[model samples]
Target chain A: MTGRTRRPPTGAAVLQPHITSAITEAVLDELAERGYGRLSMEGVARRAGVGKSALYRRWPCKQDMVLAVLSQMSVPLAEFPDTGSLRGDLIAGLGAVHDWLTHPRFVLILPDLTAEAARNPALAEAIQATIGTPRRQLASAALHRAVERGELPAGLNLELALDLIAAPIHWRLNVRRAPIEPGYLEALADHLMRALGATERH
Target chain B: MTGRTRRPPTGAAVLQPHITSAITEAVLDELAERGYGRLSMEGVARRAGVGKSALYRRWPCKQDMVLAVLSQMSVPLAEFPDTGSLRGDLIAGLGAVHDWLTHPRFVLILPDLTAEAARNPALAEAIQATIGTPRRQLASAALHRAVERGELPAGLNLELALDLIAAPIHWRLNVRRAPIEPGYLEALADHLMRALGATERH
Candidate 1:
């Protein structure tokens, strides 16, 4: 065994990051073009200009690859701005959601992934853990700040309040495919504040 | 040629409704199991225990077939109750939505079809025309009644209100997969009423 000379790991080491990035981009493109149902490791590898072995090395299957890519894209976009008031904070937060959904990549990717997640429980779990929970937490933090400032009632239903903050915009843009008019977010924020019993402190 | 006796269209004519019903059920099952991307006329026909010609006789393609089936299922379910009060009407309307979504077939079919509609513009249009429009009309009627009864402001934003009524339940059940509590709908209705400026007349 000592007589056999081992090849150096230099080439594989050098190509790893590049290969990973290429595969990630390719997976997203494939998801955008063909959707999750039609996406395959072979197609992703071909699109990435890498061998299938490289893809298998990174992800065991298409679902894992998709989850990883979505997590990478979504988590970074979950930033919630701490505007001075609850109303300001909500408008800013929802505006971010609007921008994210309307972005070219997500416009194509979200619907497909949502549909896939419906049929695939494992993917749904990954989505909630990676994308859904973090986004809700950030929005919840905004509401918590409002409660602390006495802008909202102390016993406000936080879960329902979070749903209110995000659901309308999602339904309009994604479900109804309707356009959001200018000044919509501010109006929405006003309505949400009223719904949550937010009022000026005396 | 005219002398040849007509077969009286006995077998197919007699079996038309049964065959149509069978194919419709098959399409829903196929959508639930494989989703829209993988659904095919051939598979639907096979599942229905009918020939491709039979399916072709009814609809031109898969899109038309799916749309027809969904329309049949959705239109009947769009009935909204006149509960006399804005809050009551909203709870009733949203309760219907909740029931429809949680129904066995819809639970399986809606997510996949929604996902498919996102990718396919033509399908989206068909869905909006068939399923979306009627449901909105019914819900809107309830709100209009509230306005007439002076429950809500006359100049309230009906479009936004409509989105508010339906979006949260969907986000919870479908997007978040969270369970609604026993009194959740009533509580939600209260919040929505406040948000939409619905209050008792002077």
Candidate 2:
């Protein structure tokens, strides 16, 4: 009776890395093709060429699976490198934003996910926790480093600055669906430096 | 045959203003609740308490119907009022953007339409034509006036400047689902003036 009571659930096996990768690709593809609202577990499993049990082993439902894959890809993609100067850092950070928003699969998936998230508040909160907060923290750390180095005002509005830093690229690529012209990112970094009241030499 | 060709086609009757308003409200309500993909002519007709022929009388298809309703609401909303200085102009223009984006119906409808537009190229083009271009032209006229008034540089990058002016607020309200703090719009305007190299006094 004790042994039977202590037994683990049947589908609680460890996920294989290859299967995880395949599932990730399938989630993105499914999102791109059909969008978040229409995505189904069976569809993802079929696309990944994995059985239902394999998916249940990793994530119990579609939202969990999608969020996990998205978080794994997005959180690290937001890493703001230590480029020594605030200008260099802004360029590096916003450049990552540009690349992510312009990535072929992401270009399709993000807007759909955003639409879905707006409708589903729980999903919106989940996304904020998994992706938005962590990404903002990385960028915030970069700005904080700039403040310590005397590049920005100690009284800087970090919340507003974060929005200013990334919104232009996002607006251009995602909302406008426009191409980034040459020298645009460097100019954007310069504009942000001034916008944040950075004291660095031009 | 000549007389028949000269005669007007069926369903070519002029639209009633009250019926148009009802249909417009129904379209927005339907879009907010069900999104663009799931919206149907029959559903809209049923919701508006009008017959299907009324819709077909105004627009031959669903895409055209949606676009016309969206255009009517969105295009005029982008008007940029002249406030003499570039800073004032930016504040007024972006304040309008803030109002439009955060409007209860638009808050729900915009993201869904953006997602649908991303997937449908024809719809995207239609939106660009009816909403995006007209809105940009109004803002562009404001910038052109600013150049004339010597508030901004003669060589200002208008396209980038326009993107900068609106993107931050859009990002804060729509993408981040964050609130605008007190004095935020004035601070944003100041930052934009600096970003644009405005010669006006701070």
Candidate 3:
């Protein structure tokens, strides 16, 4: 059997990257305009200039489609680098969060989807599995590294620390819909360092 | 002129307290089920057993009606009582936020409305004016009281502090969708005391 014919049943033959990009953009635009509660597969298909079968081949249903697209868009947005000092790492982490929250498309789509998830139990579970869990795990790595470097206590409350690290920025941008001013990330990181019981490096 | 004839045009006779209560309940129920984007005047009126006129009489449109109902329900949820110390005040304030976020109806409604507000500029403005501004002003008093008591620095960043005060709890409840542990509030308050640069009380 040739490698081309033996390709896994991913339907890679049908689901081209460029087509996937088009569908992804359409999903976001539709979600932004109509919200998750109002979003329909037909609308997405129409907007993406693809047949319903094209979407079906990729995802079983609307919920799966939305979750898959959002997971791809979100999971990589907050990359916490090893900046040596915990303060530097936190500041860099907060900056990543700030950038992701304020992204032109994301700023609109996220709050709406989160709101939708509040009312949809199945959707909520899907979000936690795909978006929330993975994002938290990646972000938790920075804190784990800080602990290894003797920057934080071994008995550190990792769950609470993770919450503290991400929540403030999320609240400001998503809930309050407020703008982040100059030096806001630095100030927030410093405050968080104190809050987490970490010794200041500088 | 009789006092009845000269009564202000508030339609107080038609908008009796009991009727208002029914309408308010209906609005909340409709919002919880259908969300802001899908909520309609007819649905609310039908749920309340009132005519559409009853709703329009209260507010010019659905946006105004939903905003009024939510504002009445929310603006009072975050009352910051003076506990005579910064840590005490913050813990008390965090408890209030935790209660509001976890309220059965609000737990379902707030995130949905916040999402809708992101897309609807008019709704966002009304919410800010009616809900966000009043809530912040009330919570801010706790910090001001701390400053007066010399528990906190006068140069404290009030806006950032306010964001810090509420964000973590809001994040844990609304975004993370996780259960807060038994000692979470107290722990959060202590951490916040450090973050806000307030001296520990005990």
Each prediction's Cα RMSD? 6.0, 5.9, 4.0
- Worst ten in a row by lDDT for model 2 chain A: A1-10
- Per-prediction TM-score to the true structure, in the order listed: 0.87, 0.91, 0.90
Clashing pairs in 1: none
- Candidate 2, what DockQ? 0.62
Worst 10 residues of 3 chain B by lDDT: B1-10
Model 3 clash pairs are none
Candidate 1 chain B, poorest ten consecutive residues by summed lDDT? B7-16
Every candidate's lDDT? 0.83, 0.87, 0.84
Instruction: List where candidate 3 sits over 4 angstroms from the true fold.
Output: A1-14, B1-14
Can you give the lDDT of residue A127 in candidate 1? 86
Report the candidate with higher lDDT, 2 versus 3. Answer: 2
Q: Following a full C-alpha superposition, what root-mean-square deviation does model 3 have from the true structure?
A: 4.0
Q: B1-202 in candidate 2: lDDT tens per residue?
A: 1334354577677667889999999999999999898999999999999999999999999999998998899888888888877777888998888888887788999898888888888888788888788889989999999889888899898888889888988888778777888888999988888888888675
lDDT of 2 by residue, A76-162 (tens): 988999999999889899889988787778889888888887888899889889888899999999999999999999999888888
lDDT of 1 at B95: 87
In lDDT terms, how accurate is model 1? 0.83
Clashes of each: 0, 0, 0
Best by DockQ: 3
Which pairs in model 2 have colliding backbones? none
The candidate with the higher TM-score, 1 or 2, is: 2
What's the lDDT of the predicted structure labeled candidate 2? 0.87
